[model samples]
Target: MKGEKMMKQNQQDTPLYTGLTRFSQQHPISFHVPGHKNGAIFPELAKNTFRDILSIDMTELTGLDDLHAPTGIIAEAEQLAAAFFAADRTFFLVGGSTVGNLAMILAVCSAGERIIVQRNSHKSIINGLELCGAVPVFIAPEYDQTAGRYTQPSLDTLRQALRKYPDAKGIVLTYPDYFGKAYKMEQMIQLAHTYDIPVLVDEAHGVHFSLGNPFPPSAARLGADMVVQSAHKMAPAMTMTAYLHITGKLVAKDRVAHYLQMLQSSSPSYPLMASLDIARSFLATFSQQDKDKVMTSVKQVRACFGQGNAWQLLPATKLDDPLKLTLHIKQGYTGFQVARYFEQSGIYPELATNTQVLFIHGLQPFGELEQLDNAIKHVNDQLKFVEKHATIEVVNQFPQKLDTLAIPYQQMHLHDIVHVSLHQAVDKVAAEAITPYPPGIPLIMMGERVTVEHIKQIKHLIKQGATFQHPDIINSICIFADE
Candidate 1:
């Protein structure tokens, strides 16, 4: 690896992110909890006298399957989930997929172990790296600079990465990216299994994919060793509701369970658990007519964008989620401006930066193309008032290739990180995670050496108006601890 560094990561052996579950049973003495009191958010429900807010909140008890030990209702619910996603085992998550991801990473990998990760993975992965001190092999996916968006890395790139680091712990891939672009997971899984390594998928925006078609294979079905999904992202489930699934012998269930207990909240949310079950039930009974309606609605929006010379939809090479739509903003209007336009119409997209604007359709009920049609109508009208802005930019389309390194999964002690400027960031040990959010991939990780070109690109992205993990105005980075 270029600029590879020999520094230790400062992350805990397991997870210390169970903040939510830690304060779960904090005796409600009142005068705290933001005073929402849960007493009057709804006059009728609050006054209905089912159970006091304090009484309703309880930890794992009789009839309640312990999240750490799913043998009761949680087990039953998870069984239904296995059927829903067609996985061998499924476990519910209370603190969102982020916690699910932390648990999965910690379970499959130890501190100082190497894992091939997308340069755009979620910040939590970086947190895992810091906690477990894993060495990250960063790979850039297909970045459509013109559109200001990124797609999945090509298979060639991933394979090369494997060849380069045959000892790597495994791989973590994001499905239906922030803007909705997805790689063919089956192929990635097939290649990964050949090496006897696990594949951890961050299916945050893809819970609904397992419900029906037009969407590609969910990670579990594609043979990933472990997969995490954010149910709230596309389900009627409560916020922070999600799940983790195990499908292969390479990943032991007890190992995943121990890590889940270590990283997740012990006093999980009961409502959230019930929501996951109900949402799956809702998804199970959905009609083909409804799926068609969802598809038709999105196609109309794509058609409208095609009408305007300012943008174009990237061609689909495989089965893509009909609800995940990314528009290559053209005519000098960046993803930022287009997102602003959607904002005016009260139509918020899933994500947008200088190059791409993504509109995610999760809930079929609230997802109506007519609303988007109205929004696009307003945008097209506004564009006419600007310059001869119809000229499209050069479309830089790259084939989806990947490179995998022979990185291994290991553990290291936590320490302070050494920081440097963007110019000198490369070749030095990375103390922090430099990443892009909408796609949730890291540009740099814990022990990897940064490069001058990497720094240059980071600066360019900032100048082009891209955002990173900005902890403060003076500091744009927070690195790993020094050895």
Candidate 2:
């Protein structure tokens, strides 16, 4: 009993967590940034509902330390995170991977610099490009027709992009794409380093990759100069929590710190930061038994679907994150169709596309597996053995890559922007990004010309029930008015 107690006590020795625990115990009086004053406004909050969580929803007090200039407990917590992830430095992100991408881009690539970027990069990466006025040199990733998603950029693609944009500042890539398709980042990073260009990886879906070897290698451990992981996406962390890791010396540490100060919230959420620390502490020591339990649940659910099932998982041919389930719907059925059925059966998926539905799993107990098993059975019961093949494969509507440095619209006035329909907007420079939400990559970036191919892809996605953030502009896009 004593030994068990001692072991548990030792595990709770994290820096920021320790400080937060001590601070919360003090029961400091309300007098800070949050108007709620630690749930004072909500009586239910004080009635043991979110007492503990709300208690720690604190601000940068004396010993608590500010997130922007972490010199105390926050610094220690970040240091622990760095050691856990094998990074030189780690920064907690309250605005999620979006802010991390912004900070990373701003840190490594200066304004007016050319940076090679994946065509399927998250919209936040594009926002960083817009903010920094960086010229993006696009590298087309390998597209998977079976999975109906974009996979990793091949070594050849990276090599070609590097050769073409030899003077580019660095490369920004999306690792383990939104559907949990793992990329060969180590080889790609090695190749980029050969050209003396740093590699920034948006590993938003791979925070658990480092927790268990059952998953692919984390980009943070694969020699990427900068790596951003949305801890909330897969780990036991709160939503909007993430980590930015600086793994190599190519990017100056001070520059990243500076950008983080400029980009992150001045009044950062202590709850979010504490959640990151707690999540990291939990993942650092995640038991093998827990991993086996998750694996067992996954296998049990997989077993529910037998051979000849209308919906089978995407083939795990290459290195992929086992925890992410991308189920391919066959025989003229769309992913939206399967996803709707799943929802009807009380099963919710992470994301769905025209041909596939994505389900993300984490270390926490999967209480919904039995419900999913029944859902699968229910779905299979309604399946008709149609003789026709599925015609849901999207047409190759990916537009040609920009041959020259991307023209920046950073200096352009917003009043000069004009909204035009897809057909009329062809050949016109886009004034804003038009992206589909499941995988938030911009189809047409600012200052880039809209094409018929882009229009076709947008129409196809909408036809398949895919929604957009700017629905008003889905049929049309905001573009720069004629000069």
Candidate 3:
């Protein structure tokens, strides 16, 4: 017990942050890169705001330790993170979870190899598969009628895929779907392992799951071979900061490290690395009292919304993360309109869809309940007076339980592409991915055969003022030319 207490206390130390601070205090002369010379030559307008941060925006210096080959402070910080997250090894990602996803996929699967992928996975995961020239067998997620969104694929679907493709190189998944809904992740992982298939998870929004209860269990904890998390998403870290953890040795650690060094920038930001260290300390030091306070504040916010009839909170299940609050707009009002009203009141939600808006609460207690209550009351009253539109009835986007690309990624570049109207896109193969922002899932993935349902969903989303990552493809989309 004493040894455990001492180890817990040791997590408080921030080696990388301390090293950067010590280096900055020396008033070191800059005979190096970054022409700004530590904020000295920075633009006058933003100099004041960026002064302190720029001071530590260093490159791979003598004391700073290289990211590709961490030997000192960075190695220590990553070691601490591995211990905290209960992984065999951990790597600090300077390029967000995107790079981590790419590295893991590239490391595990090669050209022409089969990989089982979640259909509703973020674009990054798809992009990774394309980059590595792997053939993806997509398993569509099961739509949660209660939450009105897609969660992880059902275990039966996974079992069928495993039995059909026993030679699959790996399985890629997203836990706690964009709406913070989690399914039987552990069971899924166990099932994959029985086939000797490694599970690589894009757990970008689940960094805080390490805090324990009130949050779903992290993929790393559930025995995923490789788990990548975006620290900046939920933790108080700068953008692009992330962590990559390797649990058991289903995938080679050296190969992952090799791909990361190739994919990530040669010069990593010291400030970003330092923020990762601080974020880790933040989670390691979070107490039971802190969790209780955060939960209380979350309940209070829910109560505030509950008092009104304008919004209906998505019912929480046992596996749902308490930090995510999804509210369905009542009375045919689009969530985009409700989101705009909230923005006018200076309250910006995480994202809004045709039927619901999602709010992401931090680990700390919400201190502005009064302001939030006022915003809720104002939105409710104002929405009553606002114009109403036909609500887009939610439907299953990916109807098929299992699918594969009509045209493989390697063969895509050889095809000629042409643009066609949304109505004419049906029965045509897509040349590019058309994705919805916020959640970042591709509605029509590259090499996928576009269907009438895809056009219908896109049209309704457009009518409701939803934003798309490929906004240029709204009226016309690029499709593979008929051979």
Candidate 4:
């Protein structure tokens, strides 16, 4: 009630931050989850430089409000966010979009229920399935052979999946994928609703889409029941800060909130929650003029590396988000080489695969066009575009229907597993997910049979120096032993 009164008094100000500021003025004594005790415990952090952040790093004391039970400032901050993103309700997330995904899945479907999910979903989504005990009916995302990347899933694919799994509780989508390629989400959502199915979107790379950008509209705006976004990924928010939006009558807000409390930390990070509020305020005040300026800078960066250059920038299609800049390596260098060069020149990219390097911008407060231009010039000056003789392209003979270790009915938990050498693991069900880092898509999902082709692909990636999460102990994989 006191926090509510304070928020009402400062109605024009940022609610969460206003509550934090007022609480800090009280100079309350310590004894909380964080052993730092307002940074007093850490002698090094007690220095002037860290004092500003550490001082305000308070817990959910009186008037500060609890994230799990948001009855005061935290609730008010969520209200502001809901209005900004045009959602029924918005919950601040400190555990990043990963936790948001888990909550959404757990809240939407009960144990043993089925959900149609895209095969290209981030590892978190699969983990969500594991946690919720939901059966995944995987539909392949549209693959771009030229770019060597997975794009959005087509409406037809969703329609087919829905038809096959008519009793499915919901459908999960990874919108504006890691590369920012958004599909016809509005139409897709409409189609899903026609079947009386709720849509849950993993808009992790698409928080800025809702903002005044030329990119396709965010899934939240187009009737998605649940939309999870990593504000830290694109917005001017601290890392691990995110927002989980709930809308429509299909999803119960209370259940989502309850699941969030279960999945998220009991002692949520105040700084992370405050950052969400600040990021929301930042985006709320963004104007059309600001959009134009960011776009102009982005265009200049694109123009700097056009045709006839060693590297070719992937043209932003109508369905693509203009902010995500992907460069396809042409000749004389691989994506890894180009990325290494950029890093050497004090310019790190968002991600780099064997075929392409990605440069993400336009969502943050400032676009790094100047640094990008200099990086491009440096790369150009350092490397020569040498023409290579044409060679025969070897067609990969992928197994048409690689056997899976587990059937649809089998409940494959994340913990039930065994680790075996890759060669011996063939024909065995994967106990743990084997995913690549940059894309984060599983090469072999848990419960799926590890095929010879999968082993060949893993070896190929290893040979190409691709980064795998569990690569230290090479040739070993986690697969469910015969039971």
Give the top-scoring candidate (TM-score). 3
Flag the better candidate by TM-score, 3 or 4.
Answer: 3
- How well does candidate 1 match the true structure in TM-score terms? 0.77
Q: Put down candidate 1 lDDT per residue, 1-483, tens digits, no spaces.
A: 332221111111111112223333453443433234433343565566633433334455444457677776567667767766777898888889989888888887787678887756787766765566677776667765533556677788888889988898989888877655566778888998889889888888888877556777677777888889988888777789888888868888887888888877666766667667777766766668878876776666667656644567755545666676677776566676677777899988778765567766655534465667788878878876765422233233222243222222242224455554565454555655566565555665545556665566566556555677646413444344342
- Predicted candidate 4 versus true structure: per-residue lDDT over 1-483, tens digit per residue: 998656434434588987897787777778775777777777774467777787788888888889998899999999988877879999999999999999999998877888888777899998888877778788766666655566666788777887778898988989878888877788888988988889999999888877745868888888899999999998889999999998989889999988988988898888889889988887777768888888887777778656325578888877788888888877445677678778877888899876678987655334565676787777776666533322212134223211222744345542456778989888887777788797898888877777788887777666555788875537588776653
lDDT against the true structure, each candidate: 0.66, 0.79, 0.89, 0.79
Can you rank all candidates by lDDT, best first? 3, 2, 4, 1
| Reference-based TM-score, model 3 | 0.98
Model 2: colliding residue pairs: none
Worst lDDT 10-window in candidate 1: 7-16
Q: Which regions of candidate 2 are displaced past 4 Å?
A: 1-12, 43-49, 305-309, 381-392, 399-406, 410-415
Residue pairs clashing in model 4 are 431-479
> Residue 187's C-alpha lDDT in candidate 2?
84
Lowest lDDT sum, 10 consecutive residues, model 2, at 397-406
Residues 284-328 of candidate 3: C-alpha lDDT, one tens digit per residue: 999999999988988988887676566789877768888899997
TM-score of decoy 2: 0.91
CA deviation > 4 Å runs, candidate 1: 1-58, 139-149, 304-309, 363-371, 381-430, 446-460, 473-483
Could you estimate the TM-score for every candidate? 0.77, 0.91, 0.98, 0.89
Winner of 1 and 2 under lDDT: 2
